[model samples]
Target chain A: MFDIAAVAVTIAIMITMYRAIKGPTIYDRVLAGNAIGTKTVILLVLIGFVHDRPHFLDLAVVYPLINFIATIAFLKYREMGRLD
Target chain B: MIDVMLLLIIVVCAIFALFMKDLLSATIILGIYSFIMATIFTRLNAVDVAFTEASVGAGITSVLMIAALSRTKRYEYHYTKLQRRKPSALFLKVISLLLVIITGAVLVYGTIDMPEFGDPEAPANKHVSPRYIAESEHETSEKNIVTAVLAGYRGYDTLGETTVIFTAGICVILLLRRRINT
Candidate 1:
């Protein structure tokens, strides 16, 4: 069950990778990167369960926090042309 | 299955990032690359390495790259706005390609003799891990082996990492501080 889900998430990651690589605009790339990051977090949890190691959740907990902050920072830089 | 796929995606991201004309897009792709790498580390049962890679690769490095990008031209001047096939540019590209191929070949060659992934009898594992796993809980009282290994067994390494981060923060502050005399 978890193997199937992990495969599905891996496919999703590959699909998202296309948008990130073939971006028509900077926003598209950023959005795709954010999506990839989210999927990676999910993959981590699924992996933890598949491997029967619950501690992987700690790493999953880290992704969204960093991903969201970095995405916001990128957008802020794009709009304001400065991080300050 | 997922492991090989993740590694493939990382390779794709690396190649695309190299060829990207937009610098910001490249930075974002590199973040994704790092994110995938952390997942691979987790898959390899190196959760501690995954944690460090996650924080440093996807977090601090992305933020730093974005900050740096904000202060510079956002496109590759040579490739995006100018003739990319200039003779000198072509020469540089060929030279860099050669360098990359040679470096990659050497790295792969070096890894040919590495013990298979997660081999229990690998020299380092045989030498160090058993002692840590057996004695760490008694010595350090950390039930988590990774915590014991990182904080108890390799305390100086952790201290050095903290010092490196502290020095980086201090340097960033020094570089960005508003001068009173200005």
Candidate 2:
């Protein structure tokens, strides 16, 4: 069932949180952050099913788009040391 | 069950982020916290709020924090023994601890009178929300009630949000373009 799947994903999120907080390097944290963002998109879609509201997919779609942008920005800033 | 678990993880993330000495790691932990919170909002049927939180919290806020961090030190400064021994620092720490405790106690006290979560007859649910839910489809023809309420009934608020984002983009452009020119 979707509820069971959601609980699993929730556990996965907690695992990623541990990695993000305990990472030894900046790149490790960024990778964990990206992984968390991806999992959130999955959680959002699963939530829509659990709530029986398919329209929530619109929000899910927007989340990944923004997540990608944020990840790219983070990486770019880290490498260049300046956004410009 | 999942909700309770999610809430517990959120608290753990918050505490971990607070104790992190690496600024980037802290920001990433905070982003995970935001992501989980957005999921919780969706579970609570506040899809609009979830959408905003996902975009602003996990996305824009992380990006902004990283950008700011790039301009500053990546690691938090550790006080040397001489600095830690300063009486002024000790006094400031004690005063801040007291202020935090007082503020926390007041906030906890204020929550005692709040209506239970998702109470149908609570003042908020009894107010214009009912009308919005009842008439959103007919008035706005949007399948998502949240979208209808946000883009139709609350046009000015959406406009303000858009304007704010636009202004932020303009400011970033201005600040960054000059560096390229120079």
lDDT of the candidates, in the order given: 0.84, 0.81
TM-score of chain A of 2: 0.92
lDDT by residue for model 2 (B1-182), tens: 88899899899988989898887778878787888898888888877678778777877777778778888888999999999989999999999999999999999999999999988889999988888888889989998887898799889999999897787656444433426434
Docking class of 2: medium
DockQ of each: 0.57, 0.65
Instruction: Quote the lDDT for B67 in model 1.
Output: 75
Clashing pairs in 1: none
lDDT, candidate 2, residue B148? Answer: 91
Output per-candidate TM-scores for chain A, rounded to 2 decimals.
0.92, 0.92
Per residue, candidate 1 scores C-alpha lDDT tens digits across B35-83 of: 8998899888888788778767877777788778877888886644356
Task: Give residue B65's error in model 2 in angstroms.
Answer: 1.7
Steric overlap count per candidate: 0, 0
Chain A of candidate 1 scores what in TM-score? 0.92
lDDT of 1: 0.84
DockQ of 2: 0.65
